[model samples]
Target: MHDSHNSTAARLFETEGTGNPLDVLKRVYGYSAFRGKQQDVVEHVVAGGDAVVLFPTGAGKSLCFQVPALCRNGVGIVVSPLIALMRDQVEALKQLGVRAAALNSSLTRDEAIAVRHSLAAGALDLLYVTPERAVTDAFADMVADTDIALFAIDEAHCVSQWGHDFRPEYRGLGCLASRFPGVPRIALTATADPHTRDDIIKRLGLDRARVFTTSFDRPNIAYEIVERDQPRQQLLRFLSRFKDASGIVYCLSRAKVDDTAEWLNTQGIRALPYHAGMDRALRDAHQDAFLKEERLCLVATVAFGMGIDKPDVRYVAHLDLPGSVEAYYQETGRAGRDGLPSEVWMAYGMADVIQRRRMIDEGGSPEEIKRIERGKLNTLLAICETAGCRRQAILAHFGEAHPGRCGHCDTCLKPVETWDGTEAAIKALAAVYRTGERFGAGHVIDVLMGTINEKTERFGHVDMPVFGAGKDLPPRTWQSVFRQLLAAGLIKVDHSAFGALQLEPEARSVFRRERQVLFRKDRPSSGKAARGTKSATARERSDLAGSDLELFEKLRSQRLAIARDMDVPPYVVFPDTTLIALAKQRPRGFEDLLDVPGIGESKREKYGEAFLAVIDAFEEGGG
Candidate 1:
């Protein structure tokens, strides 16, 4: 095993004692130092030990496996979930002079055949496959016979039955340990709580793997949650600051993704729709365009993301509430991988809350699973409605603590006011009970406010004592009360009862005034609401001012032209981060270009002259 795995290097990198994985990191990946536990992880895997890595996004988890793979002579067999992800990583590795290839459904039959031949001939350093493909008998046999460096399972949380991204194919990955007993395994995930973590360990049979955890905080991302008021207009206002930057806008449904994409295009934004409902080829085209094109926004359903490795995504806007904080965190973590300032903005409404709760109740999950999922949803609601800091609350959900307020989120910057809503909660639940728990919150609120609507009249709800008892409060305030009621579990959404709200048995104490319900006094819903658009932080190439900004756009234009000529995504040529570095520094020659962060020797040799020419022409034109 040791003889087969050593990377052409005379000595193997050791997990316990000593090795030079750091040198490999600098020479190949262009990083001079490992962040957090990356060095320790690299040493462990390179020395042939299994690991379970829990690094946050932008924490350099890729290096943990990439360095070890390069140090080992045999190819690293990586089981990743997304073809786009594998493609992006392969492109980046190629730029770093690493021999990498991916065998996925997107590949042509000939392309897959070539990759297989390469695998058998021992001509590659890394081979990426899907869990589905890895389990096939022929592929498994080939893998069993190959001199495997080790196995890495990215997005390992997908193995958890309780996880949002659960894939049945991943459940078969445990067989890797049994088939290749001595070959080490590493399971990596950016979004796993304690429950998900334990599930990953059990499912992957990684009982003895060393678990390495890094901080869950992503301080580069500024968090904002907005009450849904004129959602399209609000999204537009929040997006103004990110003009000409790449981002994603996630919707709850496929139709909404298409509609929003069309609407955004009408507003002069370069946006495209992507969902699982679209033809696979079309979806792939849209995703590739988002990755390759500058200033493109992908309006997608949850079908997108999780596999995306785009480093310069400046924003992730949710048009609806995600079911769990883990889902929201994993999706939003796609932004600002370059350690640049980014934003995670969400616009949620009462409808979003009701719909999400109804989904939990209606899911085919067992009662226990539904209960846990509902608890997670309420946790997300608390983050939205709390008067406290959003980032702190989010971190706390993952069992991590942040003592002081994180100044990055909406609630921290503009402190929210709170008011006691105990009296209001009693009236709301009273209305639900008096109405025979036959109506949703919308109807319940209408009845409380003395609305003589057709439903109220037909249902004889207007004659109830609770009718007009709370007419002093406006509709939005009542909606807030209803939402808080659901969040507090004082009321349950009876999915089978046409989405009716039933007062929970435990709410008797709260109804009897034994419990106080304090609500965050919402910001006044008036005129236009201001959004926290990060204007200055890490400067993306286009965010440059004066002359540099102009040069950045020109460089971008040239990059697109090059990509078009080569029939590749622009990022396949050089990602936005690289272009930004070029525009900022204006590298004059090959040496200076190589000094730019993303320009490894392979890329410098391949396309350095063209980029250098762009900078030189600009300098001469200035004269």
Candidate 2:
């Protein structure tokens, strides 16, 4: 490509004509209709307007901007923070018969040159780049003169400095508004509270854009919170239900992630560890395998997942408490993005609560920021302790209303029993206060139970008036009371005392007996994994039956082989959803296979025959 090629490419988007988004949706992406507010956002952008979209994780936010880019001319530049996701996104789009490419550190010199040539020649329909690279002068200089159909900033919540996953590079996106004046831009995020939403708009310079907030609910994702009791064993039990499916297990620290992944590997599971502490190349390799391999589990820290668009991630388990409800929602939201049945299993415990509280309180952030973080943590804690529907609590936190109790969460699956914890709470609060609030939950618990150990005697807490008062109750029961009290805002961690238990003003009510306290005993629990039942409409698949499951495994192997040959993720060739559909229907021939979801004209023509051959052999008793 020469210098003149830039101007020639610029003219590509200046065409006076455009196409219908709905037509592009069917002919290109293989989808029949837009879901939720996608149509509105797409139509708005197609008409040369700007917008901000807040669709849930699995709600198909990419379509809102991707379709408009195709309807018009020129390349669509998608700005995202997750470099790992760029490969998967570009590969998936390429399978859709679209000319998509990515320019990032992952590419070799030759591959980068090829992508640059395609972009300069106006051959690429979509170009994905991270914000750090997107704002660079070299990239901006190259594309400055070229015509851009649109800019889609994925996970736009990163613009919020207070967001759970803040990337400083995301702040540079405001330059897009100034740099690409007339080009339509859509800032999209899956998790953003009202304040964060407004901050994204202002920070991204999208004040003039239309705002579309879809419902923040993933009905197909069952929410299950298990109290941490033998976490590794509990995780084993959770994985048993989702055998041979891809999923992610999130940990709080790098050490834990390393240990857990190694432990899982020893248990006869092919697990990988990804964290910031690992070698960069090794981390990228692990992430790549997770996207490309079937039934691979990635045990990672929050650093691992942000924009992973893998459709068949059937479950996400958390071994530790998340910093905020927003973090938990966004992380768990990674699963079941394809609208298939999925589950989010978390093993929470008193340690998690205490650790999270201490982290928030003693964090290096300013007091004001810490205060807000504490509030978010409490919201998440409430969900873990709620006897009511978990979905309702999550949605309510997002300013959405769901009156009916959702039957998906653990509380809804097995109704929790609430006890009158007022007396227990009062005793616990008194114990914390009598101990001078200089210790953490563990020590306070020991004092309250009259377990006169070295710590109790060393701290001179044995003679405290509230010492033996709660001895009638078991230590486990008292531990639950302390957790509930902490979650209820009646007690907080004292950063000054190095995470000592401290009473809040709300605790005064317990002494006066002015307020009632109710606590739901959170015990170890698990969820029923939606074994993928086949149906045409949902286009869904998961945990299939006897024969169908065997056939699905064969199809997956075939897909994996094809993906390896193509140098793309297995999902790029065919998502598990589509594979399961093929197995259940046992498509007779090429034409019959086209009826499956994600099987479009381009994909059908490119990969259909080989798949149909396998199906034909399986059906004809050629086993």
Candidate 3:
């Protein structure tokens, strides 16, 4: 570690204050051009201006601050949210020959002292610390004595109370503006609704900073949702499509995460469980395994995936509904970070809606905050129920306008069937009303289906006129009706009354026949047909076939070997996208390999000979 740090310091000394972002980008990171608002943000920060970047995941947000930090006079201070995230980025930077270090609790005393000595001596390019550590008086005093380049706040949305992953410590970051008046500050995040965005700006004192917001659409990801029928079986079918690929399966509870992981293992899948309740050492071990292993699934609750930097996650599956569109977007954004074709799949049902609502209502939050949270949940429900493109709905939630028919989501690939269910909705509401609106969906559904169960008999609901009204329809169909009604705001789950179905004011118009209700027709629960006929993995590498595919796999094997030798994630060496480029181009020399997108001077000098040897051997054996 000391030798590598000294080498990194020497490299920094050679290139310090180059003052050209593009030069730094090519010579250090190996990308030719700047992506979507990156150039604007980089140039602004390099010119000593503050910025707030709101780009989606995989949009290259790090380069915005990183390039400027290299082109500036002093070391960049990055405020990160998680230790794992900081460590991953620091390791990747080191691989790029950049002098980077992290100050977090994970470091040993000796290691922390080494980092501090490097920072004091101006031998570091970037330093990552958590918000809790950054706000300390001792750390601030230490920074006061160092030559500070800029302050970059990653995951800036955590500063907002309205944000899905808010942390109170982030609020203290507002002091950086006053404490270091001239040092440029940049706040970056991938997910923030309009309300949260405003809150972040106000809280961070970045009102005067230029804001760069790119489209919220992740076009490479295919979104698919289905009704939760035999959820474990449905998940199995989904997993069958993505065989041996890396992904995440999010459950709503710790017990569910453990049970689902155990079940998946029994079904012959490599699975692990992660949650806050697990022992700390075991949790870290599981997380480390997920990061290092190539084809394993980490089944976890929302406690996972906040700051995960693994770029090759092929999919993100939700066994239950997420709390809000923000939460859903952030979690699903963890996939396809390489800009390759990936998938986001979810299975939801009426029970999920009830559970989510109950959790929100039973929590200790202010009334206003609770109201905002409910609204956010409703927006997510709208996305699940929408017959239009799911991407369009998601973008609209972020106040971005995207034309419908993205052609990547489930609705565009295979349009959902819809039916005019005004009559069914009225009957369902009538059942709720006739049952005194104090009974849960099960009792109300039983009354509607004309099922003479003990609860129905005990409540004397069999004598009601609404009883047997929906006898012709299957129980599942009625459940769809009730679920859609709740989603449509015609009815809601009254958690205080033990998940009773209560009609909203809008239900009156539907009962009066003044407004019609349309429900998305529930498809058969055959997970094989859940997504379209095409498999995502096949589509991901459609350009490569036969020998090219073989070469790609060989390159992956080589990358895994090198990564294992270095004790780093495979992507820290080279992302799959770079390997794909290498396979297609088949560069035979170091000069030609440098033409690859992700090959920089450092990587070309380090791994060039090994990769070329593989290519040479492959060509020698071929026609």
Q: How do the predictions measure up, each by TM-score?
A: 0.92, 0.91, 0.96
List of clashing residue pairs for candidate 3: none
Judging by TM-score against the true structure, name the best candidate.
3
The segments of candidate 3 whose C-alpha lies over 4 angstroms from its true place after superposition are 1-15, 532-535
RMSD of 3: 2.9
Worst 10 residues of 1 by lDDT: 1-10
Candidate 1 Cα outliers beyond 4 Å, as residue runs: 1-19, 527-554, 583-594, 620-623
lDDT of 2 by residue, 36-95 (tens): 778989889999899999989988888888889888778899997776678778878877
The best-first sequence of candidates by lDDT reads 3, 1, 2
User: Lowest-lDDT window of 10 residues in candidate 3?
Assistant: 1-10
- Candidate number that wins on lDDT, 1 or 2: 1
How far in Å is the alpha carbon of 182 misplaced in model 2? Answer: 1.7
